[model samples]
Target: MRGLDDHTYRKRTAALKAKRHDCWLCGDPIDYTLPWKHKMAFTADHIQPRSKGGHIYGEIRAAHRSCNSSRSNRVTTVTTAPKTALRW
Candidate 1:
């Protein structure tokens, strides 16, 4: 599915940062100052999987990129890969 545009992404991310949101996965604070590619960067996450028709900000929360990737498309607890602790 298509994701939020850059403009919308920026606006929404900024708003969450303004609210000082913490990572929904690990209870860590989101560092909005970091770029999205950073492991600790703030990302918009769906409480439900988007592939299951979830919408941004519908059931969304802020998460770290690593945290979100680690949680992708599942309701399972976050797990670390043996080598990297990341799915990638």
Candidate 2:
């Protein structure tokens, strides 16, 4: 994520809080009131990350904070290349 100003961050946070506490990616409920140590804490995530030209507020999603942080901006590869495939 880019260096967001405090005001921007707070504004975004407020908007997110008003939305339903559900994981936008998977449609799972996010228990924000629960303690983080209990593995049920909620977090705001960008559907498309800022590094990939995603708008912070326009494409936001709720997720387990840990899940969001762990995903970071790595592209997910579902299929592995064959070991014998020639190099490009």
Candidate 3:
């Protein structure tokens, strides 16, 4: 997250709010009303990731703090188990 200061983060948050975009890591809605430190609060996400020499800009997207942390620097898919009927 180098080069991505608070100013850039604010801009990304505003952009996401304006467009009403969903978090890339999770499909849940981001609650901008919450404080930035909140888990569900809006945060900047790097699509390419910063750990793999990926810059902190350009490929950036909006996401929730929890989502970004869960996703980390790698791509992942999250899903729930399918419901099943109980035997009589």
Candidate 4:
């Protein structure tokens, strides 16, 4: 995102928001009208992190500001434990 100009950045962010997608990280609704600094505000997140050599214009997804900040630049993967019945 370093070389991306303000216009392009705005355009990209707008496009992402226009998709009306849920937060990719937290799976929650995004409040498009919220202020930029607000935790639940809409944000454009790179599917692959920029700090991890992801392209500036690479695949982008909608996310809440808080979710995006919490993810940082780490690789994302899903881990689920084997299903088992539990007795109370």
TM-score of 2: 0.58
Q: What TM-score does prediction 1 earn?
A: 0.66
| lDDT digits (tens) for residues 34-83 of candidate 1 | 98799999887877787777655455678899999998897644464222
Q: How many residue-pair clashes does candidate 2 contain?
A: 0
- Among these predicted structures, which one has the highest TM-score? 4
The residue-by-residue lDDT of candidate 4 on 1-88, one tens digit each, is 3455667877887877888887777776788889999999988988889899987777888889988899999877536432335854
After superposition, candidate 2 runs with Cα above 4 Å error: 1-4, 36-38, 55-58, 75-88
- lDDT of candidate 3 over 9-75, digit per residue (tens): 6676577677756676666677778898999988878777778777655566668998889888895
* TM-scores for every candidate against the unseen true structure: 0.66, 0.58, 0.66, 0.77
lDDT of 2 at 2: 52
Rank ordering of all candidates by TM-score, starting from the highest: 4, 3, 1, 2
Give the lowest summed-lDDT range of ten residues in model 1.
76-85
Candidate 2 per-residue lDDT over residues 22-70, each given as its tens digit: 7654456788777756555777677667788866565565677767767
Lowest summed lDDT across 10 adjacent residues in model 3 is found at 75-84
Runs in model 1 lying further than 4 Å from the true structure = 1-10, 76-88
Best by lDDT: 4
Point out where model 3 deviates above 4 Å: 1-13, 76-88
